[model samples]
Structures are given as C-alpha cells and as structure tokens.
Target: MIKTQQLVKNFVSYKKKPGIMGSIESLWKREAVTKNAVERFDLEIPSGQIVGLLGPNGAGKTTLMKMFTGIIVPSSGEVEVLGHKPFDRDKDFRRKIALVMGQKSQLWWDIPAMDSLHLIKAYYEISDADFKERVELMAELLNVEELLHIHVRRLSLGERMKLELMASLLHKPEILFLDEPTIGLDLIAQDAIRDFIKSYHAKYKPTVILTSHYMQDVQALCSRLVLIMGGKKSFDGPIGEFERLLGSDKIVSFNFSSEPSRDFFNAFQPKWSDNGLQVEIAISKEELCPFCAKVLEQFEVSDFQTEKLPIERIMKELMMRPELLNDR
Candidate 1:
C-alpha cells in the first residue's frame, strides 16, 4: 500500500556567468532558480498491483520513485508506504522496500555475484537456510544459476541485469520500485525479465511500481498506468481505457489469393503492400462488422485480422493533448 498527497520536490540551482569578473560578480549576486521536479502529485497504489509510471524525459518519474523508496525526501506534502512515512527511512520500512535502477548496479564489479548476494544476506539478516533457498529459487526463475559465481564485470549486460533483479528480490520486499529494469537489453533478455517479473508478482503479490520507456515492458507487466507530464499527474487508469481515449478506430487487414481490381477497393482507400496480395484499412468500431461483411462478399479473402491502435501512438496523442487529463 502507498499514498501521496500533493507530493512536491523542488531543486535549486544557481546561475553562473562566463568571465572571471562576471563570475566574481555572481559570487555576491548569485541567481537561484527553483525547478519543480514533482508538482502536487497525488497517487494511491494498492498491494499486489503492478503499476506502470510513464512519461517523457524530465517528467519526474525517477524523482517520484526516489521519494517512494526513501532515497530522497519530498520538499512538501505527504508520502506513506506500508503505513510508515518513507521520508523517515525507518529500518523496518527500508526492509519492506527495494529500488532497482537499470543504469546502476549493486553487485561488486570485481567480485562474484554470489559474493555480493552473501553481503546482502547479512545486511538483511536473513537466515542462512532461507537465503540459500531464496537464491536457488531466483536463479531457477531467471535461468542464471551458472552466472552467480562469475564476477559481475565479466558478465554481459543481460546477465548483469538478471543478477541485479535476483539481488533486489532475495529479501522478498513488500514493495518493489523498478526504474528501467530492462533498459538496453535485447528482445530475448527483455522477454525473460518480463516473464520473471510477472511470475514473481503472481507468486508473491508484492506491490510493484515500474517505469520504462519501452512500451512492450509496460504492456507485458502492468495492468494500470499512471501517465505524468511536466512533473504532474496527467492520466491514471487501466491501459485499455487509456487507449480508448484516442478513438474507436481498429485496423483490419485482408489477404487474398491475388490482387483485387483497383476499382474494387477504391471507395475504401485500402493501403496495399508491395506484393499486392494484402491490404490494410482503418475502420471505426461501429463499422467493423458491416465492413467485414462487405469485404467477405466482394473478395475471396484468405485470411483476415483486426487489431487495436498501438499504445505508442495512443501515448503520443496523450502527450500532444494534455487536456485529456481533465477528461479523466
């Protein structure tokens, strides 16, 4: 469980002049400007939910995660995680949460991953038997049992990320904060991580907050999405409802034995592929059934498929039109 009421974080930076004289003048007359990294952000996350935090650069997603994990204190407002104020950094609260950043590593570069894991075991005060069991389970789930003994620096990026996740989850924290856990990983590696997250959540039911630029990661793991812009909450709802904001448009594709006559699809404005055997068209939700009937009657279709608009396009539309937030 987590809650935030008008959570805000402001960063202050001073402006400096170029020349030495101007710099000396700046020493006494320095200009300090405050930038709001998070502004009046309110959020509520229930236990056993995988929520995706999405936004563009400078959107304050990372800042919010830091506040949740007790890594940074909020400038104003309130934040509570598992019934404890995160800013207090209580020992028990720290034990209930973990933060993993893809760009950063907790494993010792020159030592084996198991070595770092052993340190974690002692830090968390986990029993030796429990620690061994947790490590075995994590290794089995991630399929990285062999890499545990290899030094972190020698492991590939994907291998390092897997070990990072194992290290984070070994203590079975009640809340997990993941910021770009799959960044820079290939398709196979990404899928493996996604599957592991899904399985772990289903089994343990820990509340998970994930921020990722890759749409696939969000699609695969998150049921609800919180979209933020300019350090403010833009939209918060299920992924399906977010897509519906764009419209009721659906893409329909048809494959035929051969190319149809130009006049056959002129009225529909279908986009044909280079091979000329396939055509694609966009139709509204209301017209889908009727259009399919017409196409079935007019052409000898070998195969047909329909798909909703991609999340990427829907996100782009939301970014362009911030007013949609009021519609929520």
Candidate 2:
C-alpha cells in the first residue's frame, strides 16, 4: 500500500545567462530559480495493483517515482509506502521495495550477469536455496538461462534488462517500481518483457508502479492509469476510462485502391496516411454502420477496420491542449 498527501518536490538551481559576458557576470549575482518538479501530488495505491504513471517529458513522472522509491527526498508534504516514510530509509522499507530504471544499470559491466546476481544475493541476504530457485525460475521464464554467465557488457540491451529484472526480484520485494523497463527494445523484445512482467505479477502479486513512454506496455500490463501533467496529477482512473476521454466514437481506418477525394470524407475529420492510400476517421457509434456502408459503396475500398480511441492519440491531444480535461 502507498499514500501521499500534498506531495511536493522542488529543485533549486542557478540561472546562467548565455554568452561570455553573461557567464562572467554570474559569479556572485546569479539568480536562483526554483522549480516544483512535483507539486501538490496526492495519490493512493492499493497492494497487488499494476498502475501506470504516464506523461510527456518534464511532466514530473520521474520526480514522483524518485520520491516514492526514496531515491530523492521531497521538499514538502507527506508520503508513506507500506506504512513507512520512504525518506527514513529504514532497512525493512528498503527490503520491501525494488526500483528498476531502464536507463540505469545495476549490474557490473565487466562481470558475468550471474556474478552480479550473486553479489545481489549477498546484499539482500537471501538464503542460498531461495537465491538459486529465484534465479533459475526467472531466467527460465525470461528465456535467458544461457546468458546468465555471459558478461553484462557483451549481452544485448534486451538480455541485460532481463537479467537486471531477475536480480531485482531475487528477494521478492513487496513493491516494484519499474521506470521504462521496455524502453529502446524492439517490438519482440518489448512484448517479451511485458509478458514476463504479467506472468510474474500473476504468480507473485506484487504491487507494481510502471512508467513507460510506450502505450503498449501500459495497455498490456496496467488496469489503472494515472496521468501527470505540468507537475500535477491530471487524471487517475481505469484504462478504459482513459481511452474514452476524447469521446466514445470509434476510430476507423480504410485502405483504398486509389486516392479518394478529401471533400467526401471532410465531415468525418479524416486523417490521411502519407501516401494518401489510407485514411483514418472518427465516426460516432450511432453513425458507424451507415457511414461504413456509404464509404464502401462510394469508394474502391481495399481493407478497413475499427478500434476504440487510442491511448497514444489521447496523450498527444492532452499534451498539445491540456484544456481537453477542463470538463473532467
């Protein structure tokens, strides 16, 4: 379980002016700029839930994660994780939580992955039997058993990430903080990581807080989504509700054998593909069937399909125009 009330993290830095003259004048007179990376953030997460924290760059998602995991202390407000203040750094609190950052590496580069894992086993004081069992099971699940003895620097990013995850979960932490776990991975590798996380959560039931740029990762693993914008919590709800934020209309795309005139589809707000052979349009549920039939009859259609509002589109819209949430 986790809870935060008016959680705020502020960062202070000196503002440096551009150019040589400006730089030379700043030795004693530089202005101090204070930024609230996370401001008045309030959140509560129950145990055994996979919650996705989403936002664009500089949206304070990482700041909140750092505060939650005790990597950094907040400027003001209260935050409690598993009944302990994270900033207290209690040994039991540390033991019960694990934070995995994709852009950061926990394993040594020159040593084999298993070698690093052994060090983690000692650090966590895990029993030999438990360590061996966890390593074997996680490696098998991630299909990385053969890479266990390979030097970390030699393995690909995907392989290294799998080993990193195994190392973090060795002690079975009660809460898992995953920051972009599938970042920079190919589609296959991304899917593999997502599937492994789902399988792990199902079997172990750990409380997971995931932050990812890839909506696919959120869609696959999280039932709840928390949207952060401009250092504030903008929305918190189920994935279905997040998707339906823009509207209940269906997003349908059609491929045409020949380019169709935009005028005919103008009323539907069509978004055409680069080659102009495909167009995606939003149609209200009530008009979906009739509109499709009309388009089929009017155009030389090659293929078409429909889908619910996409998370990526919603995120883009929100980032570009935060006012979309005014009605909420």
Candidate 3:
C-alpha cells in the first residue's frame, strides 16, 4: 500500500542571463527560479491493484515516481509506502519495493546479465535456492533463458528489458513501479512483456503502478487510471470512466468494396479514409443498433465493427482542454 498527502516536489534552477556581461553579473547576483514538478498531489493505492499513471512530457509523472521510490526527496508534504516513509530509506521499505525505469539501465554493461542478477541476489541477500528458482521461473516465463549469460551491452532492448524485469522481481517485492516497461519495444516484444507482467501479477498479487505513453499498455494491464496534468491530479478513476469522458458515443468503422455516396453518409458525421472507401462514424449509444442495421441495409458494407471510445483520442482532447474535467 502507498499513500501521499499534499505531496509536492519543486525543482530550483538558476536563471542564466544571455551574453558575457550578463554571465559576469550572474556570478554574484543570479536569480533562483523554482518550478513545481509535482504540487499538492494526493494519492492512495491499495495492495494488489494495477494503477496506470498517465501524463504528457514534463507533466510530473516521473517526479512523483522518484519521490515515491525515494530516488529524490520531496520539497514538502508526506508520503508513506507500506507504513514506512520512503525518504527514510529503511531497509525493510527498500526490500518491499521495486522500481523499473525503461529509459534507465540498472545492470552493468560489461557483465553478463546473469552476473548482474547474481549481484542483485547478494545485495538482497536472497537464499541460493530461492535465487536459482526465481531466475529459472522468470527466464522461462520471459523466454530469455538463453540471453541471460550474454553480455548486457550485446543484448537487444527487448531482451535486456526482460532480464531487467527478472532482476527487479527476484526479491518478490510487495509493490512494483513500472515506468514505461514496454517503451521502445516492437509490437511482439511489447505484447510479450505485457503478458509476462499479467501472469506474474496474477500469481504474486503485488501492487503495481505503471506509467506509459502507450494507451494500449494501460488498456491491457490497468483497471484504474490516474491522470496527471500541469503537476496536478486531473482525473483518477476507473478506466471505463476515463474512456467515456468524451461522451458515450460508439465508434464504428465500415470498410466498403466501393465508395458510398456522400449524401448517405453525411448525416452520421463520418470521418472518411484517404481512399474514400472506408469511413468511421460516431453513433449515440441509444441509436447504435438501429444505425448499424440501417447502414448495413443501405450500403455495400464489406466489413463493419463497433469499438469503444479510444483512450488515445480522449487523452488528446484532455491535454488540449484539461478544464473538461470540471464540466464532468
């Protein structure tokens, strides 16, 4: 479990004036500017839940993660993870939490991945039997048994990522922090990582906090979502509620063998494909059945299917107009 109240992290930087004369003047009289990377943020996460933290660049998601993990101390406010203050860096607290950041590498490049995992095992003081069993189980689950003995620098990003996950989870931490776990991975690799995480969570039931730019990652793994914007909490609720922020209209796309008349499709506010043979329409929930029936009857509909409101589109809209949350 994790909890934070009025959690704030401010970064201070010196404002450097342009030109040599300004630089000379700034040595004695530099202005200190403070910016709130995360301000007055509050959150509570129960054990055994997968929560997705979402925000755009410079939106303070990482700042919060760092604070939660005690990688950086907060400027003010209180944060507790598993009944211990993270900033205290207590041994038990560190043992109970694991953080995996995709943009950063924790393994030594010069050593084989298994070697690095062994170092981790020693640092965590894991028993030999437990360490060997965890390595075998996770490598088999991630399908990376062969790559474990290879030098880390020689491994591909996907392979390295799998090994990094194995190293992080060997301790069986009570809470897991995944910062873009599938980032920079190809489609197949991304799916593999997601599936592995799902399987691991089902068995161990660790509390997971995931942050990713990919909405599909969030959709696949998280039932709850917390949206951060401008260093503030804008939305925190069920994933389904986030999807419906743009309204309950159903998105349905139709692929036609031939183009349909503009007049027939114009009433539906259809967005046409570049080739004009495909179109997507947004239909109200009440009219969805009748509209699909009518379109099927009237058009040469080779294929058609309905989908939920896309989370990507919703995120785009929310980024442009964060005030929409007030209206909701």
TM-score of each: 0.88, 0.94, 0.95
Residue-wise C-alpha lDDT for candidate 2, range 132-169, written one tens digit per residue: 89988998999999999899999999988988888889
The residue-by-residue lDDT of candidate 1 on 1-328, one tens digit each, is 8999999999999988889988899978999989999999999999998999999878999999999988899999999999999989989998999888999997889999999999999889999999989999999999999999999999999999999999999899999999999999999999999999999999999999999999899999899999889999888999887767666577788998867765666665588999988988767888889878987888888999986336776777667786776675
Q: 1 or 3: which has the higher lDDT?
A: 3
Candidates in descending lDDT order: 2, 3, 1
Question: What order do you get sorting by TM-score, best first?
Answer: 3, 2, 1
Give per-residue CA lDDT, model 3, range 1-328, as digits (tens). 7999999999999998899999999989989999999989999999999999999988999899998898899999999999989989988899999999999898889999999999999989999999989999999999999999899999999999998899999999999999999999999999999999999999999999999999989999998999999899998999999888779787889998888886776777899999998999887889889878987888898999887438888898888888887888
- The total of clashing pairs for model 3 equals 0
Candidates in order have lDDT scores of: 0.89, 0.92, 0.91
How does model 3 score by TM-score?
Answer: 0.95
Best by TM-score: 3
lDDT of 2 at 102: 95
Worst 10 residues of 1 by lDDT: 260-269
Report residue 28 deviation for candidate 3 (angstroms).
2.6
Error of 3 at 160 (Å): 0.6
